[model samples]
Target chain A: MSAALFLIALSAVLALGLGVYAGRGREMGLEQWSVGSRGFGAVLVFLLLAGEIYTTFTFLGASGFSYGLGAPAYYILAYGTLAYVISYFILPPVWSYAKKHSLVSQPDFFAAKFDSPALGVLVALVDIVALIPYLVLQFTGLGIIVQIAGYGAISKDVAIIIGALVVTAYVIVSGIRGSALTAIVKDGLIIVVVVFMGIYLPVHYYGGIGAMFATLDHAKPGFLAFPASGQSVSWFVSTVLLTCLGFFMWPHSFAACFSAKNRSVFRKNAILLPIYQLVLLFVFFVGFAAVLQVPGLKGAATNMALLKISVAAFPPWMVGIIGATGVLTALVPGSLIMMSASTLFARNLVGFVRPHASNAQTVMVAKFTVPVVALVAVYFTIQGSSTIVALLLMGYNFVTQLFPALVASLMKRNPVSKQGAFAGIFVGVGTVVFLTLTHQTIGTLIPGLPEMIRDLNVGIIALGLNLIVMVAVSAMTPKTAMLPAE
Target chain B: MKNIRLLAILPFIGMLAGPILHNGVEPYILGMPFILGWVVVWILITSAVMAVIYKYDPANAEGDEP
Candidate 1:
C-alpha cells in the first residue's frame, strides 16, 4: 500500500484499539455506556464537548465552505463562539437537572422535564431524523478524505463502508467512553494538521497570509465578503443567530453535557471553548488557500477542496497524515452521533413502547441498533449529493425547531404545557420538512418581500411558527404540574 | 453580582454586527477580510468577557458545588 493509505489504516486500527480498551473491565449499563455514569471531570468533559466542534464537518465542510462561498463561511466561526456563550448559562442547569433525574439521552431530559413520555418519543423521532443527516455528513467526509488520500485506489463507497464498520464496532462495545478517549487523539492530530496546513499553504503559495488575500481579492472581487442580496448581510446575521440557538440542540451535544461531573465544568468550559473556536480560523485559511490554488470545484464537488489542494501540494506521507486525521475526525463524532441516535431509539422510542423494559434490556437494544443506524447513514451518504455544509444546515433546521420548547421548559414556571411543547415541535418540524421538500425559501414563499427580510435564513420562519403555536397551545391547554425548581 | 452575567451578550452584538457595519474586503485586519477579522477579534473578546463573568458570578462561589 501507498504511505498515505498505510498511515490511514494504521490510525484506524489505533482508534479501534483505544475505543475498545475504554470499556475494558467496566460494567456496561445504560448510564455507564451513554453518559460515562456522569463521572467525567473537567479535562475529559472538555475533550468530549470540544470533540463536537472539530468533527469531519469542520475538518472538511468548513474549509470547503470558505472555498466555495467565501464570506458566508465565516458564519461557522461566528455561531460557535456565540453557542459557547449561550452554553455557559444553559448547560449548568441542564447538567444539574440531568444529574438529579439520571437522564442519559436528550429525549430523557425532555421526557422527565415535561412529565410526558409521548413527548420524549416525539423528540426521539425528531432527533433521529436530524441526526441521520449529520451522521451521513461524517460518512461522506470520511469517504472523500480516504479516497483522495489513497490516491483513488479505493472507491468512496468502499471507504464509507469500512468507516461505518469500524465506528460501529467501537460504539457498540465501548459507547461514550470510547468516543471520549478517541477524541483526545483526534483533537491533538486535527489541531496540528489544520494549523500546519492553514499556515504552510498560504506562505508557500503567496509568500504570506496577507499577500494571499491580496492576490485573491484581485483575482475574484467581492468573493471574500457577503453580497448585497441572496446570501447577504441579512442572511449572515440570521443564519448565525439561528445556528447559535440550534448548536447544542444536536442530541449528541445535549447528551454530552450530561456527562460532566459537575455544573462548574460547563462554566469553565464556556470560557475556554471560544478560544478553541478560534482554531476554526485556521480551517478557513486552508479553505481560502484552496480557493486560489485548486479552482473550478463547484457544487458538492467543492467538499473535496481541502483534500484536493493537499494532494496537489504535499507528498504521499503528509497526505496520509491529513487523511488519518480526517478519518479520526469522522469516527469520533460519527460514533457519538450513532451512539446518541441508537440510545434515543432504544431508550426513548422502544422503551416507551415497552414501558417496563429493564435497563439491561434497553442497553441491549441500543447496542444492537448502532449498526442499523450506521447502515442507514451509509445508505444516505452514498445517495445524497448535497455539500457537507448543506447537509449540516438541513439538520440544523430540523433540530433548531426543538429549541423554543427546550428553552421554555427550562423557564422557572415553564409556561408551556406538555401539550404545547408537543404541538410546537410538531408544527416547527413540520414546517421545516414542508419547506425543505418543496425547495422553497422565505423569499420564494412570499413574493415581493423586501430583500433584507426575504433573504433571512428560512429556519427562522419555522422557529417563529413554533413559538406562536407553543404559546397558543399553552394558553388553551391546562398547565401540567411543574417540576419543583432547585 | 447578578448583572455580571449580562457581559455574555457582548459577543452576540459584536459578532452579529460584523456584516452590517464592517463587511468589506479592503482594509484587511492582519491580512484577513474586514468581516473575517471582525469575527476573529470578537472570538477573542468573547473568551475574555466570559473569563470576567466566570470570575464574579455568584454561581461559582466556594461551597456552591452541588
Candidate 2:
C-alpha cells in the first residue's frame, strides 16, 4: 500500500481509538456503556440513528436490489425515511419511560410491563439470536470491502479478523458512545462519497440519470412499475407494515433511544432522521446505475454495491479512502450489535439465570461478552455464503414475534402467558425460516400464499400469526397467567 | 385498550388509500418528481397518527406529574 493509503488507515484507527478513550468514564454509570450514558445530544442521536439505518446493507443491498429488482427496490428507500416521523413521537415517551425505569433492553420493558422475568429472558434470547446473524452481515460486509480493495499482503480472513478485533476492543471499552462519536465521521464520509459517486458515475457512464433509467427500462421491462417482477401488492402492504412496526423492535434501537439526553432530543432526531434516509436516494442511484454499467455482481452484501463501484472505478488511493470509510461504516454497527447483545444478556439472561448478580458484576459480564459475540459473527460470515437479504429478514422476523405482548400491554384486556410468548416467538421464527428457505428472490419470503401474498414478506406474516396466537392462547388461559393488558 | 384499537384502525384507512391512489406514481407529490414523495407522505401521516395518540393520551396528567 502507498504512504497515503497507510496514513488514512492509521488516522481512521486513531480516530476510533481516541473516541473510545474520550468515553472511558461516564457518570451515568452502566447507562453509558449500554446507551451512551443517556446523554447523547440531538445531533449525536441523529448521526447514531443514521449510522444504524445506513449499515453494510444500505451500501451493498440497496444497490443490489435496484440493480437486480428494479423499481420495487424503492422499499429500502421509502421505509427508512418514513421511520423518522413514525419514531419521532413513539420514541420520546419510550425514551422518557426507559430513563425513568433505567431500562437497558427491550425485554426489560416487556418484563416489567408484563411482570415476568421469564418473558424478559425469552425476549433476550430472541434478540441475541437476531443479533448474531445481523452482526455476521456486517462482518461479511467488511470482508467484501477488504477483499475488493486488495489487501495484498494480508489475506481476506486476516483482514476480516483484524477488523472485527478492532471493533470489539473499542465496543468493549466504550460502548454506544464510542460508536456514536465515530458515526460523526462515518456519516460525513459516507455523504461525501455517496454524493460524489452519484454525480460522477451517472455522468461518467450513461449521459445522466435520465439516460440510465431509460436504458434500464428498455432492458428490464416494468422496472419502474409497482409490483415489478416478483414483488406483489400484498408484499408491498406487508413490507410497509413490517418496517413500520418492526423497526422499533430491533434491540439496538433501544440502545440508541435510551442514549437520548432528553425526551425532546428523541423527537428532534426522529423528525430529522428522514432527511438522513433521504440521502439513501443518492446511494440508490449508485445501484440503479450499476445495472446500466456493471450489473453482474450478485449474492453480495447490498451495502457493498457502493464500495464495489469505487474499487472497480477509482484508482488505488481513492479506493483505499472509500474502503476505509466502508470499513468504518461496517465497524461501527458491528461493534454496536455485540455491545447491545451483551447488554441484553447481562440484564435479562444472567439476571434470571443467576438472580444474585450485582450491577458491577453485570457490567463486567457485558464488557467481556463483546469479543465472544464478534468472533461468532466473524466465523459465520466467513464460513457462510448465504444471501444478505435473508440474513437480515431472519433477524427482523425473529425479533418481531415479540411485538404482540409489547403492543398488547399498551391496550386490550388480554393477559399474556409466558408459554404463549414462547410459542409465538418459536412459531414466528420457524415460519420465517421456512419461508426464507423457499424465497423467490432474496427481496421477500413467505411462500405458499397465492402469488398475491406469497412474497408478502414472511416477517409480516410471522407478526400477524404471532398476534393471533398470542390473543387466542391468552384467551384460553386463566386470569393469573395473563398480564393486565391495560 | 380502546386507544390501541383506535391506533390500529385510524392510520389503516389512509394506508389503504395511499397504495390505491398513489401506487406507481414515482416520487410524484402534487405533480413534482420528488424521488421520495412516498416516504415524505409516509412520515407525515405517521406523525399525524402519533399526534392523535398524544392528543388523547389517558396518562397525560400522570406523565406531567413529574
Candidate 3:
C-alpha cells in the first residue's frame, strides 16, 4: 500500500521540480531564480510562506512529540502560532531593511550589517550546515511515506531516495522557481489534508478533541500537561525557547523571506501564518491518538505514527492522497533546502573562497552541489528512523547566534563582534554535540533539565552567552559599526 | 504610529490566546467559548492591522509593493 503511494508521489515530485525549472529556465538570473523575479503575488507568497512552515518536522516531529508528551504538545500549536504573529512586525522591518539595501540571503544581510564578509560567511556557514540534518528529515519523511503506502512494492528507502534525486535534478536545473512552484501543490494539499483530518480525526478516534484529550489525560496525567510526565519546568522553558528562537533560523525561512519583493508581504504573511497554525491544531490529536491506539515501538515508530494512524483510519485512496501530500511536504521543503544550500555554495562559499567568480561560474558550481547533498540526505533517511523536528531545532540553535548579529547589524550598532559571533556559534554547536551524543536530549529529549543545563537547548543558552561576549568584546573593540541602511 | 501600536498589541494578544485556546478550553458563547470569540477577534485585529499598514503608506513602503 505504501509502495504504490510512493511511486505516485515520486512522479509528482518529478513533475513539480522539472515543471517549475522548465517554466522559466535559469535565465531569470541568480536573483530571479532564487526569489521568483522578486514579483511573486499574494498566492505564491502565501504558498511559499506556508511551505516554509509546514516541513517534515511539522508532520512527524510535532505529532511524535504529541505521541510521547500528550496534551502539552499544545506547545507546538502555541509556538507555531506565536511564530507567525512575531513575524508580522519583525519581518516588515527586515523587509524594509532588505529592500533599502537589496539583501539576498540572511548571510548577505548579516555581512552588510556587520561590514564584514567574514561575519556574513560565518552566519552563512551556520545556515548551510544547520540545515543538513533538517534536509535529511524531509527525505526520510519521503522514504517513510513511501514505505507505508506500499507503493507498487518499492522499498521505502528506494522510494525516498528516488524522490529526492528527481527533485535535486530540477532544483539544479531551474534553481528557486523550481522549488516554489512545487510548494504550491505541496502546501495546498497538506492544508486540505489537515483541515479534513482536523475535523475527522477527533470524531473518529475520540468523539471530539475535548474527548480525545480528556481520555488521554485521565489515562495518563503527565501527557496532558506542558511539563510532561517525569519532566521538569526547566526543560519545558528551554525547549519552548529553543523552538521559538529556531523559527527564523530555518533555511527555508531564509529563502522565502529573502525572495519577498517587499517586507509588506512578509508582514502580511507573518500575521496570517498563525491561521495555518490553527489548521495544525490537528497535529496534537494525531500524536495523542498514536499514543493511545497505535502499536508503539519505542521511538522507532514515532515518525511512522502519522502514516500508520492515517492509513489505519481512512480508505486507501485517501491514504494515497495523504501519503502523497506527506511526500510533497518532505520534497517541497527538501527542494528549498538543497536549492538554498546550492546557492550558498555558488554565491557564498565559492564566491567567498574564490572571491572573483562570475555569477555564471558561481551558478555552475551551485548546480553541481545539488545532487551531492541530496545523496547525503538519502543516506540518512535510508539508514535511520529520521530525526525530524529534533534536527531542525538543532539547526535553529546554531542559527540563533546570527540573531544577535542579525538584529544588531540591521540597526545603528551591530554591536556583535564577528569573532564573538563565531565564538557563540562554536559553543552552540559544541553544546548540541556534547549533549545529544551523551544520550541526553535537551528539554524533551532528556525528559528533564537541571540534569544538563549546559547540554540540551545549547542555542538559546549559547546565544545569550554569545550576546554577552559580543557586547563586552565590541565595547572593548573598535567602533566601526557596520551599519548598512538609509 | 497609532496603528503600529495597535499592530504590536496583536502579537501579545496572540501569544496570550495560544496556550489558552488549544488547551481545549471550549466555553461556548451561545455555543463557542471566549476562546473562539478571541480567534474571531484575532482575525479581525489582523485584518485591521493589515488595513492600517496598507493605508498608512509609510514613506519607506510607498515605492515598494510586496
Give each prediction's DockQ, rounded to 2 decimals: 0.84, 0.22, 0.21
Error of 1 at A186 (Å): 0.6
Model 1 residue A172 distance off true place after TM-score fit, in angstroms: 1.4
Alpha carbon lDDT of each predicted model: 0.90, 0.68, 0.64
lDDT of 2 by residue, A1-486 (tens): 763357446645875685667576665256767876676777888777778777876776676777666656667755664455456546765676677777878888777766678778888988998898888878777777777765454567877888787888788667777788788878888889878887788778777776666666667755655663357556666676677666778899766788877666654454456555766777777887777566566655454566667767788788777777777778778877888898888878877888888888888888878777887888887786666457777788777676666655554444766556656766777777777777634344433545655556656666767777776776676533443322
Q: What tens-digit string does per-residue lDDT give for candidate 1 at A1-486?
A: 999999999999999999889999899999999999998989999999999899988888889889999999999899999999999988988888888888999999889889999999999999998899889989988999989999998998999999999999989878899899999999999999999999999999999899998999999999999998999999999999999999999999999989888889999998899899788899899999999899999988888999999999999999999999999999999999999999999999999989999999999999999989999988888886654345566678878988888888788888999999999999998988788777788899999999999999998889999999999999999886887775
lDDT of 3 by residue, B16-59 (tens): 45433343434432222233334434544655565565456363
Candidate 3 ranges beyond 4 A from true positions: A1-7, A10-14, A17-22, A25-28, A96-102, A228-234, A385-391, A417-420, A430-432, A438-458, A481-484, B6-66
Please give, for residues B1-66, the per-residue lDDT of candidate 1 as tens digits: 989999888999988876798678978988888999988999999999999999999889964377
Candidates in descending DockQ order: 1, 2, 3
Tell me what fraction of the real C-alpha contacts between chains A and B each candidate also makes. Answer: 0.88, 0.13, 0.10
Error at A324, model 2, angstroms:
2.0
Q: Against the hidden reference, what TM-scores do the models get?
A: 0.98, 0.86, 0.85
In terms of DockQ, which candidate is strongest? 1
| Model 3's TM-score against the true structure | 0.85
Can you tell me which runs of candidate 2 are displaced by over 4 Å?
A3-8, A25-28, A151-153, A227-229, A301-304, A387-389, A412-422, A437-450, A478-486, B1-66
Instruction: Pick the TM-score winner.
Output: 1
lDDT of 2 by residue, B1-66 (tens): 335325624444454355546556354453222323554465566556655555564544244322
TM-score of chain B of each: 0.90, 0.51, 0.48
| Residue A429 error, candidate 3, Å | 4.0
Clashes of 1: 0
